[model samples]
Target: MRKLFFYTKQQFFNFKAMQTAAGFKLLSMSQLLSSQKVGELNKNQKYYVDLSSVMGYTKTNDSQQMLFEQLFDSFGENIDFICDKMYEEDIKYIFRYIFDDFSDVDAASEEIIAEKETIIETPSRKRRIVDLNDKELDDFFKVFDASLYGHERFKEEFKKLVTAYRVFNKIGEHKILSLFLMGDSGVGKTEVARAIHKALGSRTKLAKVNFGNYSSHDALNSLIGSPLGYIGSDGGELLKRIQESDVGLILIDEFEKADSAVFNYFLDVLENGKVVNSQADEYDVNGYIIVFTSNITKENFRSKVSPELRSRFDYKGMFNLLTDTDKKKYVHFRVNQIISKYKEFVSEDIPDGLHDRVVCEVDVSKYKNMRDLNKKIKDTFVKLIGA
Candidate 1:
């Protein structure tokens, strides 16, 4: 195994240069001379000359007088003169002074390989959603607050949700948090789900299913194969993928739009953390997190979904319309993100005063929330870019 060594300036000099500078090669000779000295060297001199004592080099005591006589005659000045002048104090300069040609070559090669591996390995590790550490989580919320545009109350609610999950995780009970997010259209219901999924860290770790996709007659068959109807159809609709990703996230978009029959089965998974396949075998879903996103308001949802089904979820988050303040912030944030992202596309800075003009001209009354703003921005961009 190769090891990298770190050295302090004083220590490096003591080990690499001081002993070699003086004529003494045996350690005993240097020690006898220091002890027999009429006057002791100061801390600075000792620190400078202590190199020989630490490096295990220098002449022996039997040859000490000869070595001293040799040391005195070997140079224009005494050992003390050399000690007074320490080398220039830069790491690169110090390294060049200490490491040999072969040592330098080996160190450089090791560094190159390490850097190459880091560059090569990073992509495989990056994901759309990254779990946040304490500091990262704080930054994430701050960015999210800015991104959402004017939902200070919503941000507070989000903070509470995050805190709840963290607290639950600490107690070992938050491994699978089933959240039901109900709200009006164009707020941030779906965005919140996507954000949560991203925060968790990987697209592969998240499985998004559209309830509308399950409306067909073959939907059930697609989920779980025919009882005995076909060959090479052993895998059911999304069963294997969901099973394999036990600790992953599952987002059911437009939950209200899904067929009653499909949701009936989902009820079982939500409540019991287990799903029975067509084969009548129960698969454990204890480690899976289920997120249900709907455009319906809580009042309507309360009327639509039964009390029994509502009780299964740990929390029900309400995504309301964005306040005016949120709209301005959101617009500013989005403009900045776009400008920063496509800076190379524009030679001048963001079409000159475009952000302020858009924010001022935007019809806030017509837009209810983030979803509306996002759609308006999307349409506006198409016209602006002529793409």
Candidate 2:
């Protein structure tokens, strides 16, 4: 009797390695069992069946045993089966009864497969923002405040929003806290979302969708996916962004640029706290905080977005250019960050007071734009470090 081989779950997905070691093509056990006919096999071809998928086919032990016996009898010498480490005695008994010997692949092949265990052991993707423990929550505000400079009024309002969200989350009445920020080109409008993302300790890219690109007639189609039967109708940009993100916070930049259809779509999102794709898949955005940043003035905002939609925003505020004092604070923060990064990476140590030198050289008063100021900081660092 041919010996049956068992493979761990980690080795299943590594098709290349499995093929190389087993000299066979891999097939799912479920697919074979579900199919009405077993196709003819090539003389040299060998097939592997994953037993985990087979276990899901039936519930009872007797049924599983019967299925296993039939599968072994039908496949005969044409196939080998693989399974994750099964501890169940009944399942082991079936394997023992079917085959005379149980064997693993050669040691060299086992080593190659063992190396891939790390890939399998990796934790599943993080979907939502990890809730802060009581101690962490207490310190959250302080970190948040420090990260975002200027906008003291906006900070207080945001704190209130967060407090309300935590309280009302249980009642399920209030779903999402939506903030609409209007400001000039280079003020910290988008920074509000960034600060929150950082405070939440997100290691993933911030979920950002710039509606400026979706200003065309097909704006809604681009934001959410195209309908079925339409070309490229897989999934929408917003849904894709949300899925890729590790946190619940989403930043929609250039909100004023999108058309009416997109606006109405977001209206539903904010009210229902769910984003439904064209495919009708609903993503729960409840307890999420979405920050919408726009460059439109207050007059234009009123004229462009309807009053009904305007009223739905939890907080609407205009972000102003940072005060000189706040600008200096930003300079200090940026300088320290650059210096720390420099110290960590660069081996050459020139001056003890490089941070002070760099900060003093950057003239915050000369630039009103944060982007320009950031450029100045980079320039100053390059000049000082001679990198």
Candidate 3:
């Protein structure tokens, strides 16, 4: 009963915190809307959002959308109830409504502030991007270390990254620190990209893209939008996202499998620090750090490319191979995680020396190393349980 009450209180506190946050946001939104000049909108624009329809739903939208200017204005102070309900569609609708109202109002201070906050609150950064300064860079590295299990060499490479940043800053030029990270699969190349996204202090970033997906014209078009009269409209997914963020990271995995045409697109970005669109305009890529990963070797790549094409990348480094001790550590680490996860699912104590038996019994040679050990265990579990 005490634990239940404690949990209830914790939930209450969380709700209260969320309420306060929503209240502040609503207040800010209100202030911004009122302060901006909506120009002829107040007299001419017909509000298209349906307020009664939104309220009929049981929840408020996390998307923070509202229709009708009067609706937002009237309920500005009471928006906490709306945001607290996780009604994303409603929130997005209302948000776009508010933005539309502000944009019609001449997109003044209120509109700018509203859009800026909306961008910041988005899962990806929208625009007016900022880069990590030296002190923030240090904090970023610190968090990167804390997020992972083990990678002493990764930490060392990160220090080299700090030096790289300093070099870029001193040169008064904005160009990517291009890196080619080659290693065995699941050895943390992907994880490192995620860490950089979390650490780099940039509002705009992406960590990974598989080269195999870029086979069709639509696939390439999906990254950056297509020309007018295209079936559906997107702002060009990857390219626009990167441009809007200003400073971001792009982690391209399995580069060897990407179509040659994709490399043709990338050549300009690597050499000139710009991505040219179909419209003939250029997006500055100097603000980005592009990391490409592949299992292919230099000889194979050279065979595939001309000498001029090979010269585009700035830095290339091999991912470190795991040692025998490292492999053992990974095995034990995974075993502990599995035990902890399933301990509650089973009522009785685990079978005597079962973990040890499993670890000791598996034929390690059928797969690569520690990474395979976990896969083998998972496969074994699936076979036994029909999972």
Highest-scoring model, TM-score: 2
lDDT of 3 by residue, 140-241 (tens): 565566434356776687678657655774585646666676676766666566666655534345645676667655555655567657677555655555
Mind giving the per-residue lDDT tens digits that candidate 1 earns over 1-387? 111133334344333322222111212224435433423322111111222232222222334334543443332222321111132232223223232221110012334434544553232232212234665566446435433444466567667866776666556565556778887777776665555554433324556666667665666666666566566556575566564342245777778775555667777777666766676666655545577888877687888777777887777878777777667666655654454345536643445555555556566667885666767876665455442
Expressed as tens digits, the lDDT of each residue in 1-387 for candidate 2 is: 446556554444443342422234555666666324344433234566656665544445555676666666667465776655552343466566676766543212445545534343222233223345555565557557867889999899888877877777658878888899999988999988887776665546898999788656888888888898997787888888887676678999999998888889989999998999899988888778899999999999999998889998989999999999999878877776566456547854757567778888988889988999999998988888874
For model 3, what is the error of residue 154's alpha carbon versus the real structure, in angstroms, after optimal superposition? 5.9
Looking at candidate 2, the ten consecutive residues that score lowest on lDDT are: 120-129
RMSD of each: 19.5, 21.3, 18.4
* TM-score of every model versus the real structure: 0.56, 0.66, 0.52
lDDT of each: 0.51, 0.72, 0.51
Q: What TM-score quantifies how close candidate 3 is to the native fold?
A: 0.52
Q: Is candidate 1 or candidate 2 better by lDDT?
A: 2
